[model samples]
Target: MNANELTIAEARDALAGGELSAVDLTMACLTAIDAGTPLNAFVHATPEIALDQARAADARRGADAGALNGIPLGIKDLFCTRGVASQAASNILKGFKPEYESTVTSKLFEAGAVMLGKLNMDEFAMGSSNETSCYGDAVNPWKVDDRKLTPGGSSGGSAAAVAADLCLAATGTDTGGSIRQPAAFTGIVGIKPTYGRVSRWGIVAFASSLDQAGPMTKSVRDAAILLGAMAGHDPKDSTSADIPVPDFEAALTGDIRGRKIGIPREYRMEGMPAEIEALWARGREMLADAGAEIVDISLPHTKYALPAYYVIAPAEASSNLARYDGVRYGHRARLGQGDGIVDMYEKTRAEGFGKEVQRRVMIGTYVLSAGFYDAYYNRARKVRALIKRDFDEAFAAGVDAILTPATPSSAFGLGEMADADPVAMYLNDVFTVTVNLAGLPGISVPVGLDAKGLPLGLQLIGRPWDEAGLLNHAHVLERAAGFVEKPRKWW
Candidate 1:
């Protein structure tokens, strides 16, 4: 197999055994990135930075070398990489570069991982489809005939890069299913650790309370390895948890015997596709066959999750994004002769933000407005609390993990929903937002292919800070499904 196609585990072993050089692996990925430009997976290419790090890793090779030493991975555009373009796929921050690295990137670098470049994402992470990106949609490597499919968002580029072998793996953030949905659509593995499990210090904000960074990789084991290097306590981020980081890769024994997996009845939506339903049923049987007891559970507030997420995410987004008013940094609109400060703010924002971003910001601003705060923002907050309570109740009742469909459908074509009602796109996050609302760990594992030959995935939601256990459950599902399909190289 090509070096670029190797999983993290395989690459690590080869690097350790002196069979593979860091430079070679880095070159392999860089070459793939250049050849795969049609997919627009990478918005920035950092060959100089990557090669410097790889050479340093070669010289420092020893027993004390970091876990990811010499490993090449892609960084999401949301991360603030010192001296690299750190725009979060938005025009507002075009040409902006950070002076300091984000906590996650710093940790990965400390652990010896090399960065290829920054991957594309939804503008400010405000959309479910990658179409919201200012760089144009990051096309999925998977295609049916001549139609182009979305890789999912706001981590679409991360998903596409990893799935297409443009990089060994990539960093991704999930606010409302960005990581998991893309992983599902691209037939890979993605895990959104519990909120606060990973530091938010360097990642660009979307919804402060809901956004959590994670790894997107070729396999469950790769996800585990990358998550180990990416997670730790960060004094820089106040919301970062102080818990001890475990050896996540070692926790994957692929034995989920006697674990209680809950199948939330609320997840069975009224118009759910028969293929998705069948996929969910198959997931249940797989877990049961692996000795996990499948039990019916109720998260009654599931129906309210989508509405509540819309209000709360936008409300937080509006507040967090207020910092990008062209006063401090980023794109500033050229004002007319007599324009004042307010005019610059209005014009800069009008010119910088895409339509989807503007829509969410407006919704957020409206919900948080004086007269509507109680009716929208506050009410949504209350519903969010209930959603958390529902998950907590299930876990408290001996449920080891909860299983659900990662997305309502498989990958959809680009522009398929762009011109449709925005809510139609929001419905894509129906199964995912609840996990973010409750601040719990969740993962998407590819199980089977749809009738159209596209991949489908199932989600496994775990208790807060229980990613190791959740990963083990997913590992078992991955093993049972034995899904080895890859997108034909159309790029």
Candidate 2:
């Protein structure tokens, strides 16, 4: 197998044994990233940085080397990588390079991981499909015939890069299913840690309360390894959890017997595809076969999750994104003869942000406006609290985790929903937004392929700050399903 195709665990062992050189592994990934340009996965390939990091890691390889020593990773564009372009896949932030690194990236770097480049994402992390990216759509490697599919978003590029083996793993942020949805679509593992588990210090803000960075990788084990390196407490982010970071990789014992897994009846949405239903059933059966007791549970407020998430995410986005006017860093609009500060702000934003971003910003502004604040924003907050309560009740009743479909369907073709209602696209997050709203840890594990040869995944939602347990459950499911199919080398 190619060096770049090695999983994190495998590569770590090889590097430790002196069987593989860090520079060679990084070069192999750089080669893959270069050859896989058609997929648009690495929006900004950092070959020099990756090689330098790899060399440093090789020199430090000893008792002092960290868990992620020599692993090459693609960082999501949303992360603020110091001196590198961290545009968040939006034109508004074009040429904007942060003076400092995000806590997640910093942790990974401290652990000796190499940075391959910045991956594409939905502009401001606003859309369900990666089509909203200013860097152009990050095409899915899993294509059917001549049609290109979306890798799901806004972590689509991260998913594509990992699935395509351009990198062993990538950093992904989930606002509402961005990481898990893309991972599902691409037949990989993506986990969104409990809301405060990973520090969000330098990550470009989406929905502050909802956004959490996690690892997207080839397997659950790789996810665990990468996540361990990425997660830790940081004094920089106010919402960052002060809890201790556990050894996530050691938690994958694959012994899930006696665990209570909840199958929420509310997840069986109307007009759901038969394939997705079958996949969910198979996931439940697999867990049961492995000795986990599947219990029917009720998260009755699941129906309101989508609408509530839309209101809350966008509202927070509006507040977080207000700092991006023309006067500061990034793109600035040329002034007209009489254009004042207000006019410049309007013109710069109008010229910089994409249509999907503009739409969300407007919706957010309207909902947070004085007249409608109580009617929409406050109502959504109340609903979010109720959603959390539902999960709390289930956990309190001894449920270990909740099982549901990661996405309603497999990867859809790029531009397939261009003319359709935006609500149709929003429906893609139906199964995922609830996890973010409840501030719970969630993981998407590829279970099987659909009739169309596309990959499908099942979500396992865990208790807050229980990523170790969540990963073990997912590891069990992964072993049971034996989903080894890879997307054909179309890219």
Candidate 3:
């Protein structure tokens, strides 16, 4: 296999056996990134930094190497990589490079991982499709009838890069399905750990309460291997959990026999595609054949999840994004002849933020306004608690995990929903937003394909801090599904 095509586990073994050097592997990925520019997955390529780290990793290979030693990984632009451009794919943060590293990236570097560069993302992770990015959309490698598709956003770049062999694995954040949706669209594995499992410090904030970092990789095992390194408590982030991080990869025994997987009745929504239903049924059979029990359950509050999420996420986004005024850091607008500070703030924001971001901010501000807070924002929080209660009840009933379709459909074409109502786009997160709302670990594993030959993914929602078990069960599904199809290189 090509060096860039090797899974994290495969590359680790190859490097350990002296068959491949970290420098060679990093260079291979760099070469692929250069040649795959049409995909727009990598917004910046740090070949010099990558080689320097690779050389350092090479020197430490004998005795001082760490868990991710000599591994080359792509960082989502949302991560504050020290001395690298970390714009979160927004014009607002133009030319901004952090003086410090995010806890997650810092941990990865401490484990001897090399940084290839910054990957693209939806501006502040506000969109379901990658088109909201200021750097432009990251094209999905999978195409149908010559129509280019979107690797779902805002982690589209991470998913696209991994799927197209531009990186071994990349970091991604989940806020209203940014990570898992893109992974489902790109035919890769993406996991969003329970809220606070990964520290949010140094990550560009979107919806602070809902955002969580996780790994997007080629296989479930790779997700496990990377997540073990990415997770842990951090003093820097108050929301970070204080629990001990478990050995995620080692826990992948793939023995899910007797595990009860719940199939939520509310997930079977009106107008859901037949292919999605069929695939769900197939997933149930696969798990059942593997000796697991599939039980019918109901998350009665499911209908309210999307609306509540929209309200809560935007409200937090409005608060978290308030720090981007022209006075401090980032892009500042030039003052007009008689304009005051207020005008400067307005102009800077108008020029810096994209349409979708501005829209969300406005909606958030309106909802949080004194007059509307009780009706919208406050009610949403109450509904969010109920959503969490629903999951808690299911788990309390002995459901080990919940099984459902990762997405309502397969990868859709770029510009497919350009002129449509925005709610039409929000529907993409219907199957995913609840996990974030309820603060549970969730994963998307490539299971099959749709009629157009694009990839489809199945999601498994797990109990809080039970990522090891969730990944183990996903490994069983991965092996049973045997989904190894790769998109033919069209970019």
- For model 3, residues 62-123, the per-residue Cα lDDT tens digits are 65688899899999999998888999899999999999999999999999999999998899
TM-score per candidate: 0.99, 0.99, 0.99
What digit string (tens of lDDT, one per residue) describes model 2 on residues 1-491? 99999999999999999999999999999999989999998998889999999999999999999999999999999999999999999988999999998889999999999999999999988887899999999999998778999999999999999999999999999999999999999999999999998999999998899999999999999999988888888898899889998999899999999999999999998899999999999999999999999999999999999999999998998898899897879999999999899999999999998988888889999999999999999999999999999999999999999999999999999999988999999999999999999999999999999989999999999999999999999999999999999999966
Error of 1 at 408 (Å): 0.5
Q: CA lDDT, every prediction?
A: 0.95, 0.94, 0.94
Query: What's the TM for model 1?
Result: 0.99
Expressed as tens digits, the lDDT of each residue in 1-491 for candidate 1 is 89999999999999999999999999999999999999999999999999999999998898999999999999999999999999999999987999999999999999999999999999998887799888999999998778999999999999999999999999999999999999999999999999999999989999999999999999999999999998988998999999998989899998888999999999999999999999999999999999999999999999999999999999999999999999888999999999999999999999999998899999999999999999999999999999999999999999999999999999999999978999999999999999999999999999999999999999999998999999999999999999999999987
Give stretches of model 3 more than 4 Å off.
none
After superposition, candidate 2 runs with Cα above 4 Å error: none
Worst 10 residues of 3 by lDDT: 58-67
Candidate 2 Cα deviation (angstroms), residue 347: 0.2
Deviation in angstroms for 378 in model 3?
Answer: 0.5
